[model samples]
Target: MHAIIQSLCTLWRPSWQGMVMGELKYRRGGGSGGPYKVAASGRRIVRVSASSEAGERMDLLLFPAAGFAGGARAGEAGAPWHRFSADEVRRYSASLGDHNEIHQSERPIVSGFQIAEAMGALEGDRDFRIRFHYPIRSDEMVSLRKEGKAIYGVTDVLCFIWEAL
Candidate 1:
């Protein structure tokens, strides 16, 4: 497929240096509260998704990568979350060339690539698996715990992970 070929061609890029893999599952009526953007798109959001069932509510429908305008929804809670300024999330997206509505529903979200890079494992890795469960807005407080070779992005109801394989 052309998609496959294109991916291979771009493997030399910084974003592709890691042999990363992961999944973003939406449990319709469940939540995990990770940083995977919602699958829906609109000016409003209700529930959060997770890489795992950190929460139990999924209102995914429209998924955006960035570029939008509106108020952000409140974040869920379970683990302690810290503030991720709008400017940080916004600037990261601009550099990522990800300007989609779902990624920017109300608050901006940190992209998978950004997270992986932040974890200091995006480049020169043999393999990685990044999983997103929910979305972390630019203006939201998120949680992350790093252990060994894995870094977890946690929310009250969601959990995102980047691990080496």
Candidate 2:
């Protein structure tokens, strides 16, 4: 087996509780296939701990959550690591005129954009909503592993493709 398959099998143990399978019914574009069209969808999960950020809570961690038609990657996606500093948050708030005192305060906590959903700040704007996940703050760390000196975050990214007529 390939290295990727080996690693995945080692890491993920599929249970019989939840499994799905299907079959393709037919092919499109007639039998000759003038222009074959192929579609691909992918999802990736990344795990980052304070250890990866050099033992700093303020450090940032970046990953390629989405890909574009031109194969463009998310900002800082090439880097396996990033640092989330107060200075960066402050700068972003300043640039965007988000002068909320909570963002400017020197508190040990930052808000999660998901909280906005509970607070009714999120609307139909998905982009803005996701950006909230990045810039917003929380009163307490929402990361898992609340005990000891470690935290973990899990983010989901959705990407798609479209052809113009």
Candidate 3:
């Protein structure tokens, strides 16, 4: 099952990359000028300079899930950790009227929008910029945390950082 899913994701990568590149082109004329620092919770702040390609790549890396393999343990200090099942992913995709193949796979990948929904449910509505590093499989556990102006998604395999809006 994992192999099949991996192959599908591999096949889907080029199209996703093209979409991102297209969006980047569209955004070229709109953003602010050089050297911006994004504040995260606690005392961490990340600096990005618009003048450098490295900074742009770093920014891309910063923004970008799951599972319950640990016997259903509770979140630390009453934190809200969401578990995404195949059914929940289906329902969420249906609710949004999105029929993306990735969201409909046997071990469907949870959408970033759905993660935002979970974040809002836990911490109220707020604007966020999210970057995904991996695909979350069904039955995966996800947790959200707020530090200053950032919200992070914690999963067994990867961590996602969201800039609070």
lDDT of 2 by residue, 1-165 (tens): 011112222222222111111111111111322222222222232221111112111111222323111322222222122233566545544543433354465641132211322222212212111211222232322222112321223122111111111
- Model 3, span 1-105: residue lDDT tens: 111112222222222321110000001222332232322121122122122222221122111111222322223422447779999987776666554566777
Instruction: Tell me the TM-score of each prediction against the true structure.
Output: 0.44, 0.22, 0.50
Q: Which candidate leads in TM-score?
A: 3
The TM-score that candidate 1 achieves is 0.44
lDDT against true structure, model 1: 0.42
Best candidate (score: lDDT): 3
For candidate 3, report its TM-score: 0.50
The better-scoring model by lDDT among 1 and 3 is 3
Off by over 4 Å in 1: 1-82, 104-106, 121-126, 146-149
Model 3: residues with Cα > 4 Å off, grouped in runs: 1-80
